[model samples]
Target: MNEGIGTTGMAGNDHYRMTVDLNVLDHLGINLYSNIAAVLTEAVANAWDADAENVEIGIDPDGKFIEIKDDGIGMSIEDMNTKYLRVGYRRRDEDQETGRTTAKGRPVMGRKGLGKLSLFSIANTIEVHSAKNGESHGLRMTIDGIHKSVQDKEPFYSPEKLPREEIQVTNGTAILLKDIKRQRLGRGATALRKRLARRFSVVGEAHGFKILIDGHPISTADRGDLPMVQFLWSFGDEEPDLSSAGQLLEREALSDRLDAWDGDWSVTGWIGTARLPKQLDSDDAGNLNSIVVFARGRLFHENILDKLNDGRLYTKYLTGQIEADFLDADDEPDIATSDRQRVQEDDPRYVQLIAFLRKQLTQVEKRWTEWRRLHEVEKAKETSPALAEWLESLPEGFRKSAETLIAKLSALPVDQDEDRKLMYRHGILAFERMKLRGSAEELAAHVHDIDKLLAILADRDSLEASLYRDIVKSRLDAIKDFQGIADDNAKESVLQKYLFDHLWLLDPAWERATASEVMETRLTTDGVLTQDMTEKERLGRVDIAYRTMAGKHIIVELKRVKRKMKLLELQEQGQTYVDKLKKILLAQGDATPNIEVVFVLGEPIDEEGSNPERLKSSMAAISPGSRIVHYDSLIRGAQEAYSEFLKKSKQLDKLERIVDRI
Candidate 1:
């Protein structure tokens, strides 16, 4: 016996009849297909090799059975024994020597002669029925029989023959597999039909070939599942002798030649990019990123995407097919891996293909990067005018980087437009900060004029401005209501509540003040203030104090908005509160406190009022740190600042109206 062959029997003349080891069938069957699609693709490829005009696949509703029938040159019993059943046959070697072509003048798609074993990947039982000439035959094979043959030490076993009455097809072959082993998820008739469509590029009436799942034909015209293609590049136009009907039309090509690589060998067919990534939804199959590799008009490798992984953003948008028939040329070494899922990645031919793809990928990446930038800019315009302005403000270097980032973000796993907006907004603020940092003089001035300078510090065009403006306007409204207070006691309490949140209404300088806590009990204990008087006669006196960033203690005394004030009386009352605060600090042995007192009275003395000049002198003569402010004065400054901002604002009017309604 030969090393790779086995003797099944002896002829009468003493010649040994050869057969493959039964273990070869088991090995090929289990390792051949990763899924039902691969198995069905093998059957379809065999039909194409036989010059089939129509191949139909039927899936049983219960999912336990499938039928693959083809209208082709069916095999007689002798042809089946010698050719169809031969394992590991070198069909390409025979075809090259004989110059064999199918009846339709189509190149055969089968190589390695292992496609028949793919049937066992899905089912335990296979029933094959074929007819040649006027005679018909039927046979059944099972996994158990193959196992029994190996156990019995039988080198090979032949399928049982069926009488003419058992034959179902008259001029072709029908293969039925029942009791399927591993059904693919969502493997129904419709899904199978779509997979078939993606797996083959030459299934059409124009090529005199048709494929149907159930009754639905997988037609090239049915492009509903395909991504929206933008450009096509064909590689086979250089030599007419090597061209086939399956090659893309010259009119459809973006370029007649693939300029990335100039060599004796080049791949022919078409590769294209979608307008957008097809994997933009979780339900998407991620087919658009694949470059399906075909040989002899059938998918030999599903994708070469992994080989050209240059970390480019454009790869997500790419999807197409390239038939590198030179890979299977007689002179080339057999580089296809045993499972047929991929070829040897290290093969010189494949390395060349990958190198060429890397260069081509860069071209598409640049194009896609530009497309995405324009697309996102337009979307920002529709979503937010401010965002559009911010995007345009980006410097050229940074803008190009942002465009590349946008092109790389996956649209799937979740919605991406909202994510894009978030990233864009953050980028805008960061760039604005960087630009502002470059101006040392402006940054120095911002410390003293923070309220007026916020437009430069903050990203004013950002949508967050709407929220900040609403807050400021609401505080203004609360302060306006304070002007109508008549009772001193009621007015004092109302002012405390309003001023706590509306510190900006008093003076923008107080925006960073700590929340106020009442110190009435402490003041009373220090003997600097009295708490026994009536709430009315007491004038609702409350001492609210806070420490500044420089550690200076400040006391704020509130008077009713309607109360008339004498400058001398206001000064006297503030002096008592400041004295008490100083005593408490000294008693605790704290660092000598630098404290200031502020009197927020209802009104300032009028010029027409008695001794107005004397009142002004009285206030000026008080402790240097003590100052008097009218309620009207505090509100006026706040109102003026807000009015100036609103006058300059274009997009914040909505915030103004919302505050008015509040």
Candidate 2:
């Protein structure tokens, strides 16, 4: 049976007639060209296969007509009828394997003969005029004519011939499509030119190929319009280096392992990240975050960068292309999808190609992390005066260690504000950690700093450390404010507020403290420590309570900043509070409640006061940890500590203001 035979009624000549279903042509035509660019690309490919040195595409401003003209070997009427009109014709079968190249020795870019139908995708009527050997032939193909042929049980359309006057060129073909269905946007020509540049890499005089859209030729120079490539990696044998354009470029080969695929399969290309995300115009073609894949010099896919699944923040700022010609090899199955928009994910070559890309992408991610970290350190030095001073304060050896810690913190991919704040906090921690490095017990107690730094590197967080860190920062601001207060009551109020919000400020060890009570708040209306304290406990209380990790009890008392006290009176009050605390702890079944009391006063006690000598002896007789700190000395020490903290945490300009509010 003939290939075109159909199960139709027999003709009058007693032969079964062949027929085609009209719906097939309609479906293909309607679905083929989703946009005007797709149809134009197919026409250009056909021209490439025809050995055309130049293909001119012209579109009417309003999109009423489109014409694709090529200077190549023109098809005669016989060739058009036998080959061009045959749907799905195999071009490879027409000639020997060597015939895969045109007369000009260009590898044929067309395979299935369906490219001719692409003209129908955009317009209903297509006029084809051609000349070969001084003889000209022409035909007009209309969608209505094809439908009529199908209804008439005809297997193919019989195109009507046109007069010779319409054949303008010699030895070439021109296809004019009229009655366009879609209106062209004013920017369509420019957009199409850019897309065409990205879609085909073999264009330019080097290959004797040129595609002109609306008289504007798309040349290799158009590649310059791509994003600013800070660093480029060339991953194949002698692949073209990106136009330097005065940017630093890193060229290298694909790792031998990833390139070790069988059957001469290899992926070759360069991937580059923009210095900034918005450096590239993001439109229909691609954004900064795009990696186009080309097979046989034609785009098989775009935006494959997003498919790598490597969670590098810098990936969103990348743009490049990879050419895997093996996917389009002669013996390989067509892995490209029907729309030419992407490749079949399950194709073995595609799977291997993605695997290779993943490996390379991971390397790219690591390199970006290092680059950004170094950049952040540079930024910190430029923006933070405090950090500069802190760095100077370090000894040569410790300075190097501090620099390493800063780099680690800067590399964290946190938000802009948090990232800088973390750098600052870690800076202080780094200094402290180094200072206590020799004291094993002290270092362990303050290991939160070291732990937080490591947690950030691991993309985790130590919530307790962060909480106490914030408390310290805010309390530092409060202490600064308290230093400004000269009024006795006002200083007391500020001190109380500061201590209430952050008891850990006096000592980070207090971060584990269970409760805090102002001594006066425990006094009842009857002037006794009541069994159950009421809201009146707020009347006065300067005590903050702490139970160490080892279960030893501690109490801290605050005195008015400007108040002077008698040594005996202070001792009597302290002994009374201690007695009450002991009764409470002992009643809870503790055979011994190891207790320590600290008195934080605003001024030094009268040095020549009565019993001053006795007071000093009694204080030494009591717990050695018990001590008195004048408010002035305490505020000065706190200020100096925070100043050191500020210097160490150099990039904390934003966090400084935020903490001041607290």
Candidate 3:
């Protein structure tokens, strides 16, 4: 059952089961340590384990060193050599199994061992000093930049921390890193500080610690600066996650909620924020793209972000602390490593802990959504000016066209651009706006503005609107109103009203109110359904012919029918006409013009309440000459409306015909 689950590029001698990869380490140093907060996290983790009450960090951009000092129980010379020097040493489990619990019997915090390597990712050289067990000492470590200076060579050696530079330390640990790498500061460094503060909320307790960067102290609480935080579940006293092989044997006591072996230390520190400021740039993170992971006073993964299978929708908002104290060696059944270092996810204990993390995250997000609604309003001022302006200018065609569009836009309010996956690449939203991506409707409203601008250039607004009625607006409005009506009879009533009063608003071609000419459409042989489409309705009308010899032909086809089913039988009637016409025209050798089809229902059938399966099942055949109308609305009484006294006659005549036909 025990199988290898990590990196497979084992390059050292064959016998060395835990051989280190110099290439990976070198890559990790350059690629992973890309953030200021991550580097600070490593330093703070050390402080937490040392029983440090406070930790302070100072960043000096011009100077070479970034110093972090903590008031923790310092290290002795022997602990440094045996423990600190050994890479991949799994000793936390033994410590926890025996001496894992704190004075309060709380499980430990440090696990998953690889924190310090990330420091090398940021700085080439580091210096350390610790005063613990009533003794004080200082030690220095150099990354040997000269060797790493080569073009792609992975050296076999590790970071060098020698005794030559050692001095007896007092009651704390102070470390300094030289040649620092910053992810993104100066631009949004303050944001990163807040991020760090939000992620490590567990620190600064017991012997509370303080973390500083560039001489600025990170805020201990970000619930104020953050958008919304919803509590899903909090960690309570529990056993640690452990593994013999790989098959997880969960415990029996907890509720069916989710089983987590590790006891809760501090799962606090998550911060969910509203849509960010518009000026989001890659340069914002500087070099760090992800948060760092720690295990047993050591480093595990740096720049480890939400990847495939991570499956958390709001994972970008996931900034917090994960406690792994139970994995210590002193705990029963052992939760950690041989070195009391880090938690292994393969270890059944860690998996159970992750399940708990996933569950808790779901809760946080659920509550966060409610919180998002309330606080998201305050940040409206932070909306991108370009975005805000674009949305404001949406319906700018001829005075008629633009206003019509605006009216429609107002109905479906959108304030965010949720899906920005291809926005930048497609040049829809520039990279700047994309970086600060929000809800989709908000972005669509901006795109709608661009369409208006294009309309203005086309002089479509030449048509004046005495009553603010643009044909496009009228048409769009008609669709909305049509979609709103529940009954077909009410729809007939609305259409009759269109004949007189709103007649002028319609296109000149459709303005004439007459039941005299019936438009006949035909779709025939060349109808080929797309192979990729599996559903039957995917086999749709290949052609539609709107025959109007006197006025313009406005071809309308029922492409969408959410209320009824697609009447494929209607297409049969259309096909017969098309075949007869083609033969007649072919025999006479007469030239025929092409007519574009406007799906009565639209091409993208709306999403809110569409059941493609049901729609597909409803496409039965129909007879020739029978009209298949997608939308039909009538104005109450166009020019004849003033004659309300003759309501009975009017109803008997045009109204009866319309009602019976419908």
Candidate 4:
């Protein structure tokens, strides 16, 4: 059989063994790592491989250069030759005998034999210098699109090897990517600092590694320093010791490793977010997720996310990393990779591992759901004082985000039935904060600001209508509350006019998500929603009691009033209100409601009862389940309830007259 071909393989057959084009790393070298901080992530990963205690990456965007230096076990010439110097050649497992990995209890993270290729992805050249065991080596290589050019001789495919260079330090790894790609600043990019902060923040101060991007040191990731086996069910390392199957085996197998700080973790868990359409959540190249599987503190598998398509690891809401320290970086013989980047199904050990993972995933699912519920409560707490007072005070950024949150809440569609989008949106904030709880690291990234909200409203993500409405609603809430504070009739008139214009004044009280059957009765082509005889919804006059999930008063409206309508003849409006109250009693769900209603006028400005006949007929035409009342009656009732409104209006008028005289 040909070494390159498997069993009569055709050129297109995936079975054909082929190396990934140096172009992958080549593309990544300059394009993917174009941002200074992104390139630093690679350097940080490498430093972890070197068992570095500290690493720093710096950039001079104007100078167009980047430098990364690390204090780690620097490389010997032979080590450099077999590893760094030889592309695709790695003796990582063999190096275990050298005892570099054990002290850290983690093997090196670079195995693909090709990550260094990424250096060239962003820069034209990479200069490297290092020393170890009293020996030193330094070298430099230029990409020059060498990976792209094919040679007429020598078969045209070989990785470059740099021999030696002038050295300075006794023992350390320093790399400079000259002619580096970075975000331009000033007229070019004022955002370099922020983008850098986002990228290397994961390479935080954890374990022994301390990394910095540009001038700012990386902050700890939420889960940084989380022990490998904290709170996990433990089983002793007698892998073959379990003598039975089922629950008994599970219980018996979860014994702790003798020296495992918290005991060797035996349970492995998988948790995922729900699947949505590609339009909503794309997994395409542009949106590809890289599942970094760390073994011995190195990325053994970079894009394993594509493999977990069993619909488990790829959930949009799912967050976590697949972890196992003992599993070899090479998941082969025992595990295999298909041309599709999927895991081999028949691999027994891999299957066993996954099966074990699935079981643990069950626990993980439970944990995540618990996390989700708590998350929802936390988010709800942000809005409601009861929930707010229950939770601890938030950090500065969160407190500062109150207005944004109000805007978000205002734009939300009535939470009718199950509003998945609202839940998901709030879930994002909740999950983020929940993870941040007790996290020593302040969030390094920018909080979603008011502009971001406006941008989102402008871009119209799935929350387009609601987000926009929320923004308007937030402003309304602020003004209305203030209007009530003044308790003046003039202010009340302003508030009333605002509510009429927004139409959200009719929203369910308590701000609980609500639903209404909107029937449009346009007298013109403009398509105004009105109460017409066309009668799409079968509604009758009744009480509009609506209990709120959020506490507040429910407001209901009878679409429009008719001039000759008998029910709201101003004389009968109160009785009609009582009748509607009786009607709302019948349409009960599990939800008992808090409700109110208004008889709107067809000719709102009409005199002699504000278009009485039409109003009466419309009020009479009210849905039987609805709690309804006359528009005129409501105004009268409100004024009666708050006589202060009338007094304040008179006072304001007097004050205006006095000021005019002055």
lDDT agreement with native, every candidate: 0.63, 0.65, 0.42, 0.43
Error of 2 at 314 (Å): 3.0
The TM-scores of all predictions, comma-separated, are: 0.58, 0.59, 0.42, 0.40
Task: Give the Cα-based TM-score of candidate 2 against the true structure.
Answer: 0.59
Question: Which residue segments of model 1 deviate by more than 4 Å?
Answer: 1-20, 95-100, 182-186, 221-225, 228-264, 274-287, 391-420, 435-662
Q: Which scores better on lDDT, 1 or 4?
A: 1
Candidate 1 lDDT score at position 197 = 67
Better of 3 and 4 by TM-score: 3
lDDT of 4 by residue, 350-405 (tens): 44455555454456544533443344445555555532531234456454233334
Q: Output the better candidate (1/2) by lDDT.
A: 2
lDDT of 2 by residue, 1-662 (tens): 56545533444556576665665766555457666777777778877877788999887887788888998787888878877777766676676753467777776666666767877877889998877777788899998898889888875678888887776667788899998877423247777777778778678777789999888898754654343776666676745634443554343445523636885777777777665565655474445468888776777786677677765456756778778887777666777765576778888888888888888878876675456445655666676666656667767856655554555444444558656665566546534543544322232223335564444434424433434555457767777666665344454445655664555556656665555344234433224333332432453344343334467666666667667766766666567656676666566687677767677776677753555666666555444456676656657767776666455444545434532322
Model 4 reaches what TM-score against the true structure? 0.40
Q: Residue pairs in steric clash, candidate 2? A: 518-541, 518-542, 518-543, 519-541, 519-542, 520-540, 521-540
| Number of the candidate with higher lDDT, 1 or 3 | 1
Ranking by lDDT: 2, 1, 4, 3
Clashes of each: 0, 7, 97, 59
Say which prediction, candidate 1 or candidate 4, comes out ahead on TM-score.
Answer: 1
